[model samples]
Target chain A: MNTDTSRREEHWQRTRKLMFITLTIWFIFSFVVHWFAAPLNAMAPDFFGWPFGFYMAAQGSEIIFVVTLFWFVRAQHAIDKDCGFTEED
Target chain B: MAIIKGDFIDNLPKVYLMYTGGFLGFVLLMAIFEQMGMGSDTIGILFVAFTIAIYAGIGWLSRTMAVDAYYVAGRQVPAVFNGMATAADWMSGASFVAMAGGIYFGGHGYLAFVVGWTGGYILVASLMAPYLRKFGCYTVPDFIGTRYGGNLPRFLGVVILAVASFTYVTAQINATGTIASRALQIPFEVGVWFGLSGILLCSMLGGMRAVTWTQVAQYIVLIIAYLVPVIWMSNKQGFGMIPQLVYGDAVQRITELELLHGMGTLDPVAGAKAGLKALSVPFAAAGDSWQFVTLVFCMMTGTASLPHILMRYFTTPSVKAARQSVAWSLLFIFFLYFTAPALATFTKLQILDPNLATGIIGKSIADVQALDWIQKWSNVGFLQIIDANADGILQLNEFFMRGDIVVLATPEIAGLPYVISGLVAAGGMAAAMSTADGLLLAIANALSHDLYYKIIDPKADTKHRLLVARGLLLVIGAGAAIVASMKLTSILGAVAWAFDFAASGLFVPIVLGIWWKRANRQGAIAAMIGGFGVGTWYLYMIKWGGMDIWFGINDLRFAIIGMPVSLFLMVVVSLMTEEPDAETQAMVDEIRIPTGETVLKAAH
Candidate 1:
């Protein structure tokens, strides 16, 4: 994997800021939202007769993580390119 | 260049042959009895007995004595075989059982375990392993001492290694015990003893040679144990398609039942009869917004910190080999990790309601697994329900949230023969024992490699150094066995804090050390000690003794606060100090060069 040095550097600070932002979003959906929602939705919606809270708490994080890693990998790669160490093998 | 001298060693045929013979022997015996309808408990006992026999057999076969044979298999393991051992080391009790449980309990937040576990290898390959291999040391502290030119840095590394390894081992022991009790119907203490004995045999008698092959065998058992249930679940569903078996009828039936229950129309146990409603909502709520940032940061960093994972590079012959090994490990790991979600959905469906399809369990066929355990587990609240309206049976909404049952439950859901249950039990024990041994051995090696070999006696020759490592392995193994006896949280829960501790401390300095020419002894030492100190400190304040409220927030999120501070102090101090001398710079140059010749040169 070639590091595309010609790739323009986005703001170094800007990159960190965006990661921080996305990371924040990741957490809310994970620990905070699920923790509070579990008790609140006790016996709530029945999708296919399944509790919504159960699905999210058990299965939801996987999707978010896929997205999170997708974002993180791309973002870090871009930063690496800008910083000039793009030789990814 | 190493590009030409690279070689493949193939002794695994002997090992794999042994593995196949053992597994096949068990499968045949278990299947015959199972088709005849043996009870679950008998199968469970068989499972425990079989594992003890196989582990002991391997120990006797290896007959490894000295530390070299024990530790790093004398650093003679072929890459592919070592990769297999490392994969087993990395998985442990927490990974095999607890990961599924976390998904069972926390859902998606637990996804980080997969990402962090796999992704950490990337950092290790790219950032640390190769160079460390060039340094050619036996322990992390040795590498630190040589690189930084100080006893202070070496001491710090040893401390960090011990603390991380000990805490992590606790969870592995804990999880193994849980699996043992579930499979064997024994008390948790008995199971803990089962786990401790395996480690004692491998670490105390066999050393790394015995430990390494044992781990490789354990990996096979674990993978098979996990998959057997999936295969059975799939087969029982017909054509063995897991997604269909899991998600096929379950979604519709559950949704309809839940909506009916919610509207007060469906029977509490059977789910509402009103057409199954669908419950689908996105997780897009904002607040003080959610704490997504910290979780990701913690995981990303944690991936970088774990000691067991980092230690694998020491076994590789070169830096490139180290990098390649990481890629290999992830590729192997994904084989199991990819199956998790499907397992989650399928198990949820299999157990969606109290009474699963009677046709399957009631069939006039053989191998009936008494799900009395399911009701028993549910009674303990590991499994549960609402009985929303008090119907005699269970409804879809009754599926309870438990953080521990998923892996243990896999065999039950698949309706595997009791002998298979025994195999799965053995597998779970394997995961727990291998992980515990790895951590214990690392702690032991630090005592010898870092303390006695490098610091106290540079004068000590190879024989003396070997003796020291063997002695330390015994001491550490006994100490850890004592802890295993006590029992603790599930492996994942106990180790989760360790990950947070590692992420903040071990990840940064190690990563920085590889790339930064300006990373002086002062900066490197400061980064390691500071990163470990502050990381441990944050977890200590928040997680230890259960007193974790910092400024009104839980401590897991704040663990990474130390990472940035460590990074800062590292850079600031490096800039404030004199640059590395010519000898040090030359050493770095040699490590960076991708040639076996240079390595040979350095050896001379």
Candidate 2:
């Protein structure tokens, strides 16, 4: 019984690690991308005719958000399987 | 259970075909009306009637007497459809009509609204949805009641939920009035009643069951309504059909115009209230960057904590389905959001281009009044062509357009015919009504399920509970309608305040409740009171008391202060007191695992 409890605790720790990494990426895409947009725009006024920072803020960050979420979902599922927390069919 | 669940999925194609056929037939009929030269007012009325009829028909078909069906659609909804409905429910009038308009007026700073709102779903899918599903509750307050092992926490949850949800619902009702008046060519006061009846008809029919199916249909209407004008405008402007990829040229041109005019700089004679005439600011500028980050924090956290949105997850079939549903919702929502900036860019091009504006740069307002679209919209007070300098010709600074007008006026701005304008108005109505129905149900459920059934009549049967839920829905719906009809000018500002309140008051407690075993009833109550109190007080002081900033944070973004304070109180209070008992700890363990089934834990 004690071993079972310890195993569960270990599984939760792995899950938390995944959460930490994903949240860091989420923060960077949401805040840092927008924060540096001006410098990028000034560096290149037109990236394929889009003001560089305007393109990143308006469209680029949103595209990255969709990708980030899907990656998190896939990674979390793998962790769940390894931890033996996958639901039985 | 498996067979029953499969039945809805099996019939989905048939349902899709029937709805599509009916909608196409209505469009054909409208096209014929256009050939007959029907007046714009008549055409607008016909558009409203046709769309409302389809929603009303769906409401009647899905009506149910069972409590399970009324509250959570019997927990049988397939994920993809629920995702579509959630998208429609989540994208309110602000997203549909005002976001592009806000971006149009506020420039890059406004993109924070879009990024903040969509990014919040990351938190939702990761932390809240699956566990809430595993808890297998009917409403958020229901979870609070059982998790805390008492009435006080549950009652307090209801109070906070009602305050947040009611503020949101009133704003949605105001949006409904604006769309109805624009579509039917009536006064906004009369339009409020027309909009209220449509909302009540669908929601009162079958509670969540009616609302869920109706929202699916509303989603189709709104997305089509949103895309058509943008596609047309893109092709007309030579961006081709893929406006999302090629709108950069338009932004470049708009930038050139802004630099030439120095428009965003305030006009001293008109005072600072005249507002931005150009977009010259850089990113990472200290004041604006902090404002942007705080607003995003508030919006994202607020999105995860909103009771109306979270309730949609409870209707899905399993914990995996709940997780899948959030991803699908983002996909559906991105279709509109990605296109919004494009819409703003193209519309700005039309406003700036000499050929589209027609009259010479120095021509009189009278000369520009000859332009049909300008003449029509100005009559409705949506677009104002002010010649502030009393010059006969129109200057870039002379035109002042509101944010709400940007989406609704896009078709007209692009020189589309009357029928397309009517369709855009219908889409706006769909966005507003779908959100209003979800909010009304969230409030009604808090009162009926949490307050009445749990506290007032614990032994009440399922049938009795359903009756009380429907009754409360009508009462709350009427009250929101009355507030909306007052034609308050600050409706949008009020909606922003509600988001700050929800983020501050609900986000910390709800997240810690699920993740931390040490989170006790006293901690949650203290966090709710402390967080909500600080948030509301800050809002009142700055908005009414006339302060510019509080402790260096703007009043509009007070959640930055309120949230951390609440988190501190929750952690400190929980450590000072006893942890949850053994059974409660067991309940949290049960929620943490992703079991295939969503069986309810027995009550405390």
Candidate 3:
């Protein structure tokens, strides 16, 4: 019983850690990209007609969001598998 | 089993190809008519008829008899398709027509809409969606009522859901009315009634089942309608097909023009119409960071908490599918959102290009007034050409137009044929109607399921509940139609406030219920009252009390204050009170696990 409890605790801790890391990336991509967009646009040349900061804020972050979403899904699924918490079909 | 799943996946592509092929055939017919020199009015009517026929046909075919099917499509939707439906349900009129214009006028500062909305899905995917899916509930308030185990919490959930969704649906209906009036050539007041009838026809036919399939169909129309004119404008303007990457040059050019005119670069028109010159300053203006950040936070959190959006996840087959559907939703939504800023940039260039502007360096106001597109749109009151300096030639600052015009005028601005303009209008209508259907279902179901069945009459069977739900849909739809006809606020402004209220009122309890074991019924109730009450009172103060900023926060960004207060109160109250019953704690634990079994529904 004690071992079972410890296993559940360990599983939750790993889940929490994964969530923390992914959320940090989510923050940087979503918030940080917009926060520093002006400076970035100022220093950068027009790439494909967009200023660097403007491109990132308007376009690049959405791409990052897609990538981040898949990454989080894959990582969480992997964690669930390793922890034997995968939902039975 | 695997073979069956693989076969189903293979069928999806064929289905999409057939649908697209059919839609494109109609587009070809419209093009032929344009080639025949058909008038714009005829094309607009044709476009409206064609789009509505497709949606109404889909809604009719998907109509259902069983309550489960009506409420959630029998929970059989695959992840990618559910994602498409959710995207359609999410990209309302504001996103389809106004977002690009907002970006065009507000510049970098307006990226808050982009970041806030897409980022909210991250919260949904990680924190809310999968757990709620695991709980095996029908509505957002269903989860709240079930998780907290009470009538009052459930009732309060119904109130919050109704308030937020009603505000949101009214905005959608307003968008619909505007698009209908413009396309079909009717008064906005009568157009709202027309729009609401269409909304009721789609939703009342089959409930969520019809709504889901209709949204999927709407998604295709809206995406095609959005891309065609944009891609054409980009190619014509020498940006090639990849407008998303090449629009930066347009921005640089606009900035240069601003410099020549001695107007500051970045967001020259932000809040220009609102008479808030303080907010109309340049992008990343001083002391505006907090307000900007709070705006994004409010939108992001609000997106997660919205009942209509979260209800989309419940239609998916499993918790895993729920998470994957969110990713697909972002992908589907990204196509339009990513292009919106580019469209904004391209439209500005079209408006400002010397060849197009034509009233050269020393031209007369008469010359500027003779510009055909200007006369047409300005007559619609969407554009204002004030000769502020009494100079005959047009100055960049003299062109003050509502942001919505950027989208509505795009096809005309690009000199595209009238058929393309018709297509864009149809797409905007699809966006508004699809979202309105989902929102109306959410509001009606909350009253019928959460309030009526669960609290008022637990013994009510599925047939009785369905009847009540459909009746409530009519009442709420009519109520929203009345409000929409009033035109109290612009679509985006009303939408932003709806997001603020949902985020502030519901975000704390929803998040805490999943993560914190100590959260009790008392905590949930207190949090809702404290957060929603404070946030709403602040909005009232700002709007009617003639107050300007509350401790450096504006009314639009009140979620920043209300959310934290709600969280604090929930924690403090929960700590002071008795913990939840053991069964409730176990239910929370069960929810955290991703087991595929149907978890027992919360007992009354």
Candidate 4:
């Protein structure tokens, strides 16, 4: 029981660390990029015809969000397996 | 007993795949009927009726008396299908109907809604979904009641759920009414009843079992409807097949056109009539970056906290599935979110560019009014063209179109066949009805399960409990429809308020309940009451009571004030109060790990 509890604590710590990292990336993409969107758009001529700020706000952020979610799932699953915390199927 | 047999559950993928193919084929048949000279009205009615009939059929087939099936669909939903259902549920009338219009008018600022909403699932997947699933409660309130060990917190949970979901559902019903009225040429007031009846037919019988399957079907229809016109418009405009990737040029062109038409300078007549301004300019419609950031924050937090959305994860088969399901939900939703900007840009191009076949700018008023699509939409009061200048030529300032009609009118605007219009109408109805079904179920289930069964009468058997739930579903749904008919608020405005209320009241309590073991019942109660109360007070004051807007937080983003209060009170109060007993702490630890069976399974 003690080992089990310690294992659960370790698993949660790892999971929480991963979650914070993912959310940091999420925040940067969602808010930080959009906050600087105007400057990004001004630099559009250098980076293809697409307005980088507008594209990120409109399309690019959504794609990253999707990828981030899937990646989080895979990473969390791996943590669960490593900690012997995978649920019985 | 539920009708969902083991074999049937195993074949969900195959079954839904075939259903999608069959639905597309049906749309094709409608297109062929259009070629055969069928009236557009008849085609529209056929599309609406056929899709509703399928939902009603699924509701009938999946009708269940078992408590587990009724509340959580036997907890057997696969991750992918649940994700699709959630996407359908999340994409309400505000999303399918008004979002593109918002993007068109508000420009880059409104993408806040899109970003915040999708980003919310990240919070759900990491902080909430799997933990709640492992806790194994049927309703969100069940988690609150169990975790907090009291009825007050549970009662407050139900109240918050009802307030938020009821407000949200009315907006959806309003959207359904708007779509149905246009499609069937009925009055908006009467169309609401039609929409409500269809919503009832799907959720009243089988509960979650019915709603889950029907929502999956709705997702397929809505995505197809949403994608077809954008793709068609893209190809027609020589932008190639992939509109999502190719629309940057169109956005740039739209920016140029806005300047050329003096839209950047905002005509008083255009501003007063339709609120039209620069379409592609960043931060033009949202007033400034502060409002944009706050709006995104409110929407994202709201997305994580909404009871109906959180309930979707409870239907998944296991904790693992719940975590994965949030990703699927975001992915399916991403399909439409990524396309909305493209649709907005392409439609604006069609209106502004005189070279395009659908462009009406600088055209003779008589000629533009004679256009079939304009005539139809104007007849419904969604579109209006007047020779205000009396020059006989329709200037851009003389044209007025409601943002609500943008998506529905896109097919017609791009000069697509009438069949596509009908399909889009069906899609809009699917989006509205699916969301309404979920909200109605969420409200009804909270009332019956959390309030009545758990608090009012614990002795009530499963049959009695479910009956009360179904009865509440009928009552609450009709009540929402009545409120919707009054048109008290714009669909998007009401949705924004719903999110604010949910975010302020529920987000802190629920998140802390899982993560913070010291979070006692006092803290939970304080957070719920303090957050919700302050938010409501702020909204009432700013919106009606003539209160000053504090720190630039508008009525719509009142949660900005409430959420911080809730968090502050929760942490402070939790520290001031005694920590929860060891058993509850153990329960939290157990929920943190995904290896065990659901803790509350036997209790239910």
- Score each candidate by Cα lDDT: 0.61, 0.80, 0.82, 0.88
Q: Against the native chain B, what TM-score does each candidate's chain B reach?
A: 0.84, 0.94, 0.94, 0.96
Q: Return the TM-score for candidate 3, rounded to 2 decimals.
A: 0.94
Residue pairs of candidate 4 with colliding backbone atoms: none
Q: Note the residue pairs that clash in candidate 2.
A: B263-B277, B263-B278, B264-B277, B264-B278, B362-B393, B363-B393, B364-B392
Candidate 1, superposed: residue stretches over 4 Å from native: A1-89, B1-9, B36-39, B63-69, B242-293, B353-371, B378-401, B461-464, B544-553, B597-604
Worst 10 residues of 3 chain B by lDDT: B275-284
Q: Alpha-carbon error at B462 in model 3, in Å?
A: 1.4
User: CA lDDT of B575 in candidate 1?
Assistant: 94
Summarize candidate 4's per-residue lDDT along B191-244 as a digit string, tens digits: 999999999999998999999999999999999999999999999999999999
Instruction: Give me the iRMSD of candidate 3, please.
Output: 2.7
Off by over 4 Å in 3: A1-7, A45-49, B1-12, B265-287, B355-363, B601-604
DockQ of each: 0.08, 0.49, 0.54, 0.63
**Between the candidate structures 1 and 3, which one is better when assessed by lDDT?**
3
Instruction: Output the better candidate (2/3) by lDDT.
Output: 3
Ranking by DockQ: 4, 3, 2, 1
lDDT of 3 by residue, B1-604 (tens): 2321335445765776788888889888989988999888999989987888878877776666687878887777889999999999999999998898888778777877887888889888888898888888888888888888889888888898888899999999999999999999999998899888888888897888889878888999999999989889889888899887667777878776545644553233332345222113232222245555677789999999999999999888788888899999999999999888888777777765665542222346687677777798768777666565665666655566777767878888778888899999999999999999999999999999898998889899877888999999999999999999999888888888889889888898899899998899999999999998888888888888887867777767888878888898999999999999999997887787776465554222
Give the lDDT ranking, best first. 4, 3, 2, 1
Return the DockQ of model 3: 0.54
Model 4 DockQ (Cα-based): 0.63
